[model samples]
Target: MFSPKLLLISAIAVALVGSILAISSLYANAQNDEEKAVNSRGMGYYQTTGDVLDPAGSSGSASTGIEPMKYLRTFNYGRVSTLPNGTTLREFTMIADDRQTMEISPGVHYNVWTFNGTIPGPTIRATEGDLIRIHLINNGTHPHSMHFHGIHRAEMDGVFETINPGGQFIYEFYAEPYGLHLYHCHVQPLEEHISHGLYGVYIVDPKTPRPDADEMVMMMNGYDTDSDGENNFYTVNGVPFYYMHHPIEIEKGRLVRVYLVNILEFDQINNFHLHGNLYHLYRTGTDMEPDDYTDMVTMSQGERAILEFTYQYPGQYMFHAHKTEFAEKGWTGMFLVKE
Candidate 1:
């Protein structure tokens, strides 16, 4: 019933519509492929899964037996001094008088001698309402004091009036803001003391409960030395090359969360890179928000990052400073992915 001219026009329109749909489908497919590539290369958002080791014994309980948020403790044995040149220097022996070097990194195996002979001395993981008691002992000839980075009490702040060599002071105060934090000596020559390794990480996890898995804390510190050289050292839980203490051990498809704190005394920036997985940075210092998610993050001095990622591949991956130079200079750590 239709004429040849009308039929030809209708056919042409159909062909044009079909061609448009085909082009759109191809474009969508290409986009999907790009996303897959990025994720497989550990460059995008991807969920990780794995088994968590029970910190307890065969009975499956942590050995420490200390309740999750009960009590926390630490010791600070440092020294402070006023040099003849009027450069007030606060120095602390990383090595304790006992001669046992604290484990700074897990890979180093042998403990590196510290100013007080202890890597990060000791950790104080407490809750918001718990009172923190730190006994500062001046075993060295110089006088020293302990100051909490973000803590609130003025009396217990460890100012000059409250610190002295051979004199002990107990800092008693309740924890307020919760998140990754730092504690160090606030004497005149702070750069000298921190360079000598007289600082540590302090964490106050939110009162809320978290999933069952290993809890790891890392502190990135830098030192400027005149004799040897200037370098940055990544210490896990307070020991340089102590990555072994808090190695990320996981089975295929396990969720892991890492709390990274930067206690660097200088203005150097740090980039945290996870080699084989994508992570979500859920919190920063005392600020927690949904927008903090990211695969890579940067932290300046006095900042903190709380990131969670999963392991899918079965191999050993590394988490280190993306600065390249820092990683090459031994400012790196490891993460093991097991099947």
Candidate 2:
């Protein structure tokens, strides 16, 4: 009952409908694929697809369990407090987010934005399973936050929650599985924030404290004089040639514990070397046992170590980065051992 021309038109219409259906299905598939990609890469507060609770796994951008807070006992110091609940409570506060000129080396000054007006904020210490609270006030012309190497709720992790100038923030978390860690301003242009000295060391001691010893803290850092993405002057504990000029005094035959942290930016690697001794090294405080016995250890940026040694004899011993240029640039130090 249909003419030939009508049959041709009908076939054409059917083909058009099929093409439309095919295109619609393809488009839907593409949307699903994009969603999957986003989920895999993580979105928003989610930094990784891996288990966030795993304190031993590596999460994206964060050290997670591999690399590495806070609470209401209002405090301005960096020490651990024990709670009746078997949890240790640690508290800290930092101020001064504005820029100021600092003496990087002897007669060499650079403008730095500091926490508490120091190049390396404050050294914080605590025991494993301790709860920590940090209060931060921003007095500079920028927004910033404190990001630590610990496990915590995503919202409490301190990223994306920035405190603007004249503002403040409270960060709290538990210190898990002891280790030497770091805290820094995680704001954008991280290089600028960290390089300007808004960083510090965090030490989480083991439940059974390592044998009593003479404990000390040393941190390595660098200053970029020209803002050229390369460090010009290297320092330990904020000043260049400080230790070389005023060597650390120690008692011979006494166990010495050193919490060493490296916060140098724009450098490939920095290191610590002792001229006259070897040390039992804990490459982070995670292990109950020493990781190795060595004379020198190399650390990348933000890495830390716990070293134990006993000077067998009383004398002057040298310690510094093995990188000769860094040493020449004022990273050298000495330990004066006495009976």
Candidate 3:
């Protein structure tokens, strides 16, 4: 008689083979589609009144010199809206697209999938108790969805709702318990999606509001250049050694607040180290009181904190991950203080 273990192994192998074959066929089709000749449309302005009325005797041809009838707005970040009754409404329209062989630093290039053509796409800002409405347009060739780490309803949750190509969805939620957060594509093969640069920083300011200070967003991310289940290059924003080349300028005797976020994949722990300074750290930005005061802080994947500090003396200061190898690999930056 055949052993039960042998039969189970045989069943698993057959299922794996079937799945591989299906995926291979899909890839072949996608390759073919990418090779098709695409007609380029000339840029022109057209009147859009939300009506489908066509011009008289107009032929559907590129030579017509008429642009497509669609509502288009400038791609930007940190958009806010307010009602007369003291309520705030934050709105954002995100377009997910993929670019081929985009430059990471100066000479390094990677196939980057992006939102609004930028890695670590636009930083979204909102105040506590405000409502956020995100209009996600799936203009790319694959399915995508936005999953935000905030309190929201199940339908508003992007996990079970995958929008196909040319589809759209509206995600609305109330921003509560203000803190540092992030948003990313939550489709299947989640790691691949995130590694492709489909993530961004989301900030919810506290209700009572901290003291006025110069603020900046620093999102830690890494790229798996060889697809080898390891990150070869790491960055604070998107480019390697960007801040090292062009240090962020700050004024002396002024408060500086940083929204620090870590979304680096394949790494369980990433820490921040500041040279010649200490910060009042607010863990997760959920409380009014700081949890500690220190020069270095560590966070696991998807963790964040709000760090506030002031430079008493003016000089150039460096900041990087405590993991020396990570800083050498490109996770580094500097703060140039002015007298």
Largest TM-score belongs to which candidate? 3
- The lDDT, on a scale of 0 to 1, for candidate 2 is 0.76
Q: What lDDT is obtained when candidate 3 is compared to the true structure?
A: 0.77
lDDT of 1 by residue, 1-339 (tens): 699988999999999999999988887743332221113223344432433322111212222211112111242322434457653333333222222333223222332323344444355566554455555665554556677866677887877543445566666665667776777766667665565556666776566745664556666775443324455454334333234323456667777767677766554577788786777776554655543656577878667777777776787787777877766544556667788
lDDT by residue for model 3 (302-332), tens: 8999999999999999999989878877787
Stretches > 4 Å off in candidate 3: 1-86
What is the Cα-based lDDT of residue 321 in candidate 2? Answer: 95
**Model 2, range 183-255, lDDT digits (tens) per residue?**
8999989898888888877777777878988877787888898899988878777766666656688999999
Using Cα atoms with residue i matched to residue i, what is each candidate's TM-score against the true structure? 0.62, 0.75, 0.75
What local distance difference test score does each model get? 0.55, 0.76, 0.77
Q: In lDDT terms, how accurate is model 1?
A: 0.55
Worst 10-residue lDDT window for candidate 3 reads 65-74
